[model samples]
Target: MFRWAIIFAVIALVVSLFGFGGVAGMSKDFAVILLVVAVILAIVGFISRGKV
Candidate 1:
């Protein structure tokens, strides 16, 4: 999931450089969402590991 976020971020950067405003915006949004989810999942995993 974190890798996916990084991929989307790279895509957003490339598209922005090429002046693809809409695509860049969408990709950036996806990256942010994925990154948030990844962080949440990581925290959950850490907590669960502690309990175990």
Candidate 2:
């Protein structure tokens, strides 16, 4: 999930550089969403790991 976020982020950068504004915006949004989800899941996993 995190890896995908990075991939999309890079893609967004590349697309933006090439002046594909719409594609860049969409990819950036997806990357941010993926990153947020990944962080939330990681936090949940960490918190649950110490369960009795």
Candidate 3:
């Protein structure tokens, strides 16, 4: 999931360079959402690891 975020970020950068404003914006939004989700999951995993 985190890797996907990085891929989207790179896609956004490439699309922005090509002048695709809408695509870039969408990709950036996706990247942000994925990054947040990945972080949350990571935190949950770390916290739960001590339980077992």
User: The CA-based lDDT of model 1 is what?
Assistant: 1.00
TM-score of each: 0.98, 0.97, 0.98
Write one digit per residue (lDDT tens) for candidate 1, span 15-50.
999999999999999999999999999999999999
User: How are the candidates ranked when ordered by lDDT, highest leading?
Assistant: 1, 3, 2
Over 4 Å off in model 3, which ranges? none
Question: Which pairs of residues collide in candidate 2?
Answer: none
Worst ten in a row by lDDT for model 3 = 43-52
Residues 7-47 of candidate 3 have per-residue lDDT tens digits of 99999999999999999999999999999999999999999
Q: Where does model 2 exceed 4 Å of error?
A: none
Summarize candidate 2's per-residue lDDT along 1-52 as a digit string, tens digits: 9999999999999999999999999999999999999999999999899783
Candidate 3 clash pair list: none
Which model is ahead, 2 or 3, in terms of lDDT?
3
Q: What is the lDDT of candidate 2?
A: 0.98
lDDT for 34 in candidate 3 is 99
